[model samples]
Target: MTEIRHYKIGEDRFKISEDEVARRELKVTKVADDVIQIQEEIHGIIALVGATSTVNIKKDELKELIKIVREEFGWTDIC
Candidate 1:
């Protein structure tokens, strides 16, 4: 599978995603699940779109998903 890459240019950040899903909601929402919704703003209609607001995941599955998200966006627990 192809992976998206993140980079820094001066004070700016950027991402190049070959994966279609990565470009849709994932960039704005991600695992934080904290994207503010403006009144009347419509959600994107894309692949993997779901009607439910939440999903039940196994502990191990969540852990692994988090690790991937962190690494994908160059996030770390340390400053």
Candidate 2:
């Protein structure tokens, strides 16, 4: 198994490196009326295909998601 290391960059962001020069961007799209798909791409190359979930994101679930983003980005609250 490969051991992944985490580095804390300046204030609110970090970089994940794998000894490769790649600029990855996450793409989230509504593949179907109710199905959502996510993917990771680097220079137009699809690196990973993310999970597909229902578009019906509940209130509680959304709150938890918001909390996760806020904590990770060092955002205590949104203005």
Best by TM-score: 1
Kindly list the per-residue Cα lDDT of model 1 for residues 7-77, writing each as its tens digit: 21112122434532222112112333332121111233244556756433445544644564456544565
TM-score of each: 0.31, 0.30
Taken over the whole model, the C-alpha lDDT of each candidate is 0.35, 0.41
Candidate with top lDDT is 2
* Predicted structure 1, TM vs. truth: 0.31
Worst 10-residue stretch by lDDT in candidate 2?
5-14
- In model 2, which runs have C-alpha deviations exceeding 4 angstroms? 1-20, 44-79
lDDT of 2: 0.41
Per-model RMSD to reference:
13.7, 14.7
Mark the regions of model 1 whose C-alpha exceeds 4 Å error after superposition: 1-52
Candidate 1, residue 45: how far the Cα is off, in Å: 20
Clashes of each: 0, 0
